[model samples]
Target: MGCRQSKQKSKDSLAGAKKTGSIGNGGAAEAEFSVISAASKTCEKLGVSSKQIFGLRQSWKGIKRNMEDTGVEMFLRLFKSNSELKNMFHEFKDLTSEDDLRANEALENHATLVMTTLDDAITHIDNYDYVSEVLRKTGASHVRFEGFKSDNFLNIRDPFLEAVKITLGDRYTDNMESIYKVAITFILQTMVEGMEDALKNKAT
Candidate 1:
């Protein structure tokens, strides 16, 4: 009887492990499908057509490239004329922290907050103040800095929104206009704040 019970317990443990693994894989698959669906919906709303959206990844690639280019240009304008900003930018670009493991974890946390808030911003179009607060907290957490000023935010906001508008086109109009704006704002804020932390760490 004891031997039989031991065998049964081992079997149950193995089954539980397999079930957990399956659940994890399914969760990951669902997340990927959700992202794909969101993209398809955006394209459809923009008049891209369902077939085109799925068939050509190039359009999405182009959008990302354009956004990056726009971001680079805006980054240059924000830091180019100012010596301090330029130095800070260089420091950030060349950062190699002593505590790399912690830094990596911090970055992951920062990314999660930013992405989550941006998604929330898209969903909650009416609550601009709440969305803004999320963005602010995300930025602060990323940089580990106090007192992130409004001007610092505005420097990146215009170009970021322009990039989104250009990329999304009619989709921005179809979904609540504020969603795209808040999403872009949250993204740029996160990027800038993360860079700020990297720069500060490098400087120290």
Candidate 2:
């Protein structure tokens, strides 16, 4: 008798599961819907719509083709405006010339790493949980570097946009520029949050 009751309960559970799965689909069992993203919500608040997301991914394809050069350009722009930041990187900090900076293996590798992180963030733009965790970890990792401050992430803002503008050349328009601004701001903000999280965890 107990065995029969157990079998009946299992059947009921399967039936209930089927019913719950069909709740919002007009009684059709097709589970077609949108994936929710915390990151998307934050982006929306920052004026990045689905349309802009599509544009970012599209434009990024061009950037990815020349990742190394673009990454180097970004860092070059950064070093240009904030010359003092170069001291943080011992590998190429002593080099004052643009040609030397571009030729340095260390700077190239660092630029590649930064660009790769940006690529990941853009790739997973809709997935808030993933992007935030990645960015936060990135910030946390900087804790070990001497003179590294969370605000340093903010410094990427202008240089990054300029780098993109240079890379895109004729493709870069006023509207696209606006979208890129929103995208980078969102990326840097999360990174700062991650840095702060890391600092707190370290203290504890």
Candidate 3:
């Protein structure tokens, strides 16, 4: 009697799953997965083609880089474009401090860190399910900073591209820009998602 009851319950669960079109039993993987990333969903909604993602990935692999140098160049470009933007880094830090910044040991370390994170993110782009959590964590952490704004991500895009252009020189092209833009867009969207969630949790 006991064995018969257990078998009947299993059959019912499978039958219900088929009716709903889900194949597995309830669990965390499915739950986490069911929570579609803002980045992935936005890509679809914005009609960002798969070609963009693929093109971006392929082009970057061929591009050369002195990661630290490129990172430094990017920040330099960033500060130059909007010197006033540096004040956000402190309660009232002056533009001179931001402008005077150079590619020193600390900057080199930071540059390497940025390059490694992006390298890893790009490497795992094909399997977003694996990378989303880490990106989300990054987004949440950014929110904890003393003074940060979402626009900072958008604002950095131009500088980042400029850095790439300087690094790649003749190798840089419109297609490559498009690729970088796509990758950066995805990253920013994911980060915003995580940050928003973090904020929401704090509010509650």
**Which candidate wins on TM-score?**
2
Model 3, residue 145: C-alpha shift (Å):
0.9
Q: What does candidate 3's lDDT look like per residue over 118-198, in tens digits?
A: 667765564465567777777788777666765565666788788888887777788777767777677767777888888
Alpha carbon lDDT of residue 165, candidate 2?
A: 86
lDDT for each residue of candidate 2 in 2-87, tens digit (9 for 90 to 100):
11122333454446657777445343222111233343454555666666666777888888888889899999999999999999
Cα RMSD of all models vs. native, in order, equals 15.4, 10.8, 11.4
- Which has the higher TM-score value, candidate number 2 or candidate number 3? 2
The TM-scores, one per candidate, come to: 0.33, 0.80, 0.65
lDDT of each: 0.44, 0.78, 0.63
Question: Model 1: clashing residue pairs?
Answer: none
Off by over 4 Å in 3: 1-54, 62-64, 88-100
Task: Look at candidate 1 and tell me the lDDT of residue 87.
Answer: 42
Clashing pairs in model 3, backbone N/Cα/C closer than 3 A = none
lDDT of 1 by residue, 31-131 (tens): 44444444444444344443332323322344444443434443444443332433433235343443442244443343344334444544432233444
